[model samples]
Target: MWRAEESKEAYEELKKKLMEGLRENEKIESILKALKLFNSRKDRIFKEVDDLEELREKIRRAKEEVIENLDEYIEKAVKKMEENLCKVYLAKDAEEARRIVRGIVGDAKLVVKSKSNACREIGIVDYLESQGIKVVETDLADRVVQLLGEEECHPVVPAIHISKEKWSEAFSKETGRDVPPDAQAITDASREGVRRAIMSAEVGITGANAIVAETGTIITVENEGNISLVSRVPPKHIVIAGINKIVPTLEDGLNIAEATTLFGTGQRFGAYVSFITGPSRTVDVGLETTIGLHGAQEVHVVLIDNGRRDAIRDGMKEMLYCLNCGSCLASCPIYMSIGEKYSCGYFGGIGLSFGAYIFGAQRAFVDGLGFCTDCGACSEKCPAKISSNDLVREIRRRAWERFGLLLPPHKKIRDAILETGNPFGEPPEKRGEWMKSN
Candidate 1:
């Protein structure tokens, strides 16, 4: 389990992990190699776009509009979904979300899930496990994390820090077989494990990549086909997503999904995109439509607020525009050094801002607010044009205001500039002395 960011113990542990992560040459080399591969695919995505900048601008404007009028859009989405014979619930926080989910799950013994960072954001996995529900993750990376009992290191690649040998060992233990230390072998084992879990599950829970307000459809994009099986095979389907994920129309939702796929994994499109509009229905038996004819009988959507509305009120509204594409994580130098151990909640640069607002400013500070370099790489790669560097700087200023925490070096430099009018602590006349000789 990941430690709480606000605690002193967690702060100390984060420092230790950061040091260890930086010095591990093998891990560093693996991550750098992954980065190279990602950038190569990312370049190809840009090459295929006719007007990437125009599309980005359009998405930015759309996101801003949606966030600005979030309440109205949510209301519209709920109404439309209910009209499609789907149940909808609004949760103000994590606790409320978990409670509503439990009610929907009722007497379910086994639950299957797809890849969903939003579920992590609400602590749903832990909550369900505590309630005695056997929850299984179907995503390959998520499955690895589950078996290892480790926190998700990256949003897209949850077990990116784990090597192939480690994964092979985990799979061998899970299946009670001598598994080869090969990528395909490990994946095949995971597929078998997840398929069994899905077949036994009574309830299926997932997070939506995008929610269409006009049609009340939930859209999910994935490379693995697990999401498809989990949503279809079960008798009950539940979608838990943030209120900010709602878009005005299906077209707008697809646009956002396309950008997210391109920026997240550097793909032209996801391998599988599922558009679900409610429970499964068939009219073959008679003239009337029959629910549960092939797929799920009931569909439930829970939209959680969890400090997001408060974030807007606090002037950190721009964060709501994030597509969770994870491009920012790949570009962050600090993230590359410390991995996800320094993460407050989400991954990489944007996590700093998310930590401040969602997890609290004090927690975020002790969690490593000063680590950011204020570089604009994250901003440049963001599909929605969010300036995460600026957000980090803003959070840094707030940290000082709230807790008076400042790096000793920065404090000394500021003091020197104030006292001697030079960062070198020299008189103004000597400021150019080095330039004269060198």
Candidate 2:
């Protein structure tokens, strides 16, 4: 489904997915259940914030400062990381990123990966698999999605649509036995599977929460504790991140962590937060330095730009301010009906913004650019407060400008309005003509 440019195949596939998601389905019920749980407790989560606007504003401004000066920050961060003995590369796009990672892999059989939206964004799993490299997902939800042959529905909870029975089925296939469809049983099985994969893998891959350019620190936040294991157990760790993840300081990274949990999971913070700088090292034995004592011996960070640079150049910088939080989708009416299939690569109006730039404006139309109602719920719930609705509308306008195919449905409505004074094409007269019904 991933291509350097727009493809007819991608459009048709996404259109089919859009129709499937719109119908009544168990995934819709499951998504509704998850959103209900999230909605019920979000008030308590936000109530703890002493100065809500101040916190949001501060975080936004700090990130905006870095994004505005991303080139400088990336340069400084790359220098610092290289000084810390980590291999670094600036990948101009997804293909270059895949090529760099493939070179690092060099025929390695197993690569264990933690939860990473960036990895999904660039389609690394399929790429590696095509090269005969077996990539195992150490994260439980990601494992389930892989087993089910499904893509993520939400950023925080990728397997929200999966039920306990489905979980057992997904794992039972791997075990070749009848595992019980119970929560504890599923968790135990998944944990064992991930442990085995991590223990045997030669390389580990991860996405970033934020990168502190001042100290060359890469921060990853999670609750499952798999990120630490995946990043450490393997001899080599490879990190793929968007350039937008760069921040000026560790304090900024920590703020991003807080915002991620607050908006995504209604928590003040996640249970496990990992700040990795360079490879593992020690200097304890006779004051002699050694590396790879209990963690990765080598670390590689790939800073991927894709279309982000062009997006900024075209005045679409707000699209990069997303935290990948699913808060907006929880309230998105279109998302409620269609789940993640509404958008091509990701979930809601905000996701459409990213898809538009990365996939192209014409493909964005097929990715459900017209589905958004400009409700503004996304902006209200967004921690970054990036007017995603407005951005999506702007992308739709661009789609129309580029292809002139985005307005046929709207043209029909317009014609109906002009002829009958109603969008529904109902017959109409002057103002007093409707009194007959009463």
Could you tell me the lDDT of residue 131 within candidate 2? 89
> Tens digits of per-residue lDDT for model 1 on 1-438?
223332445456556666877787766666666766777899987899997888788788777878989889999999999988899999998889999999999999899999897888888888999999999999998988899987777778777778888899989999999889899999998888889999889999999988998999999998888998889999999999999889888887888878888888899988999999999998788678889976889999999988889879878888888888888877888877767755778877688788777777766766777778888888888888998888888877876666665555565787899999877799888888989998
Error of 2 at 1 (Å): 22
Against the true structure, what is every candidate's RMSD? 3.7, 3.8
How high is the CA lDDT of each candidate model? 0.84, 0.85
What range of 10 consecutive residues in model 2 has the weakest lDDT sum? 1-10
RMSD of 1: 3.7
Per-residue error at 151 for model 2, in Å? Answer: 3.0
| TM-score between model 1 and native | 0.91
Predicted candidate 2 versus true structure: per-residue lDDT over 1-438, tens digit per residue:
234234445455666777898774988999999988887777787988887677678679877998899889999999888988889999988899999999998868999998887888789999999989999988888899999897778888989888899999998988778879998888888887789889999999999999889999999999999999989999999999999998898888888888888888788889999999989998899898799989899999999998899889988898888888788988899999898877757679988888887777766777788889998888887888888899998887776666654445575797788988988787855555668668
Clash-forming residue pairs, model 2 = none
